[model samples]
Target: MRIAMIMNGFPEISEKFLINQVSGLLEAGIDLDIYAAVRPSGSMRHFAAERYGMYDRTRYTRAARSTKTRVLDAPRLILSNFWSNPVAATRALSTKRYATAARNLKTLYFLEAFGKERYDIVHCHFGPNGLTGSFLKDSGIAKALIVTFHGSDINSYPSRHGTNVFRYLYERADLITANTSFTKGKLVANGCPEGKIAILPVGLRMEEYEFPKERVSRDEATLLTVGRLVEKKGHRYLMDALPSLRTRFSALRWRIIGDGPFMNVLRDHAKELGVSEIVSFEGTKNDQDVAAAYMSSTVFVLPSVTATDGDMEGQGLVIQEAQASRLPVVSTLHNGIPDGLLDGRSGILVPEKDSPALADAIGRLLSDKDLRETYGNAGRDFVAETYDIPLLTKRTVDLYESCITS
Candidate 1:
């Protein structure tokens, strides 16, 4: 079946799971095309973009442009594509959405670009894009529209835009997928029809992470956390836990991967807590570097908490990534996290924002090598059986078929 995958951007470093899904779907012999709302921002493109020849099959339109650029570009953008798809351009200009097009040239830009394609289904990766996908469907660009809500889309977005902001999108969409049960609960609580929601998690390529039998046995315990340095990641709480942890464990080293606005704050917090020497803020790492960090570490921790903006964790993808490496994971009992992590099996889960609980969980794992190994093995087995890429892709295929037939 021919499908159009709609996204905020293509080949984004942090959102490579979408790229992996595209690659997996293609390998499964599905015909696909990508339509991106925004031109990519960073230079660090995933290699799979080239490997899968996605560029040739993808179309992108800038999401927002300055008023000056819009005025200058909109005329040319409309006229240039007029001869190629005159009907679409003319029809787009006459539609009510054209009012939006007239105001925001990027709206017109997306309409003009996406108007060229015809697809059986339009699958939007995040809830915000459901409107664009529904517009495409309403304009007869696609037969059905499916939107997947990850994290902020269900959490922070509602707080900012107000709870019913998704009312139109939800009413227009044909299907909705939530990455975790907690997220699905939130969707229904916000008025989405419960029957339409399904739990389709972000998956991992299990075989790539050749489950380490044990964390490196060493003089110093190496703790690892891989996530953006943001409030939602609970880095501050981790720092809070460390000061007390230092009292019990003399040889402790913490490595943090990924960077964000909270870097300075976290660094300052670490310094203020007198744990700066033990903590290493290793900024964003490539795949190989992350895997190496996973292999070298004793335990993986995702101290996630609900952010101040109401943003919640969407079932920590890093949890499984760590588990795939057979590393024991310690995370908070935050929204969606419990769905991915098996408490006391994959790792331990503590109450949110409780530094003492987090420290105790980590300390328990650190002291017991056998417990770590047992949890690590169980975690890998769970990923292999449940969250493996190939396995999840088949489920996706079934969902696609159901959408097409119904």
Candidate 2:
């Protein structure tokens, strides 16, 4: 299958799931051309991205602050490097309209990218990009469209872009996949055709993780969470849960593994709650760093909750990732988290924003070694059975095959 993946950027820290999908697809005898609406802006690149020579295949749209900058940069970039990067140069030609050059130049970039390629499917990674997919098909790009809604696309995007933002995408796209049933529900609520949407869990790259032979103990008990420090990640509530947990497990250490806008707010809250020394702000660690943290940590928790502005987690991939590394998880029953876990069998699910419940769950896991081991082993088995990338990717491929035949 020939596929064009429309994405926000390459090598993004948060979008490793997409990278895993791409790598899996390639391994399954599918050919892909990665089309980034913007360039890879992050300093960290996934090991798979580097190994597969993806940088050589990636074509980026001109990302600029102003329309004048975009218009100027597009031609200059294409003209100067047409011989070296013929694909991008041909896609971003001088034939686009003045209005397009001023506003929505990325549309022109997208048009040109798919314009030159004959693809079996134009798969968009999020709902907003699915809007672009619809535009591409309407322009007579001979391919079916498939979109995957992971999280914020349904939670934050719809609310920000208006409820009818994806009306065209729903009507035109051949198929859609949701990361969780919660996200699928949100799409159906917003007028999507229910039959077209499939629930596809974003899975872990099993090779990259180590399934511990048995529960390993750390010298000093540590509780860890990995995600951008955002409102929905419920880091503040984790901070609130800490004071209580600290009293019981005096040597307990907490590590937060990503950075975002709420850094100052979370730092201040940690200090205000008098747990700064015990809590380490290990900002923006890479995948290898995370894999190591998973092996070392005593327990993993992602106390996710819905944000004030209606934003929520669709599927917390980190929950599964933590489980794969054999760490007992303590997370909330927020959104699609419960669906991702076997709950009482694999991990504990507390009510959202319930600091006492979260603290208590952590305490229980810390105090009972056998219980922690049981949950850890069960969690790993659950992920290995249900969330393997190859199995999940095959399901995605079946969706693509259905899109082609239907």
For each candidate, what is the lDDT? 0.81, 0.81
lDDT tens digits, residue span 145-180, model 1 = 899999788887777766776776788788999999
* Candidate 1 pairs with clashing backbones: none
Residue-by-residue lDDT tens digits, candidate 2, 147-192: 8998888888767756777776788889899988889998999999
How does model 2 score by TM-score? 0.90
Cα-based RMSD of candidate 1: 3.0
> What lDDT score goes with residue 323 in model 2?
90
Question: How accurate locally is residue 19 in candidate 1, as Cα lDDT from 0 to 100?
Answer: 73
Residues forming the 10-long window of minimal summed lDDT in candidate 2: 93-102
Off by over 4 Å in 2: 65-68, 71-103, 211-220
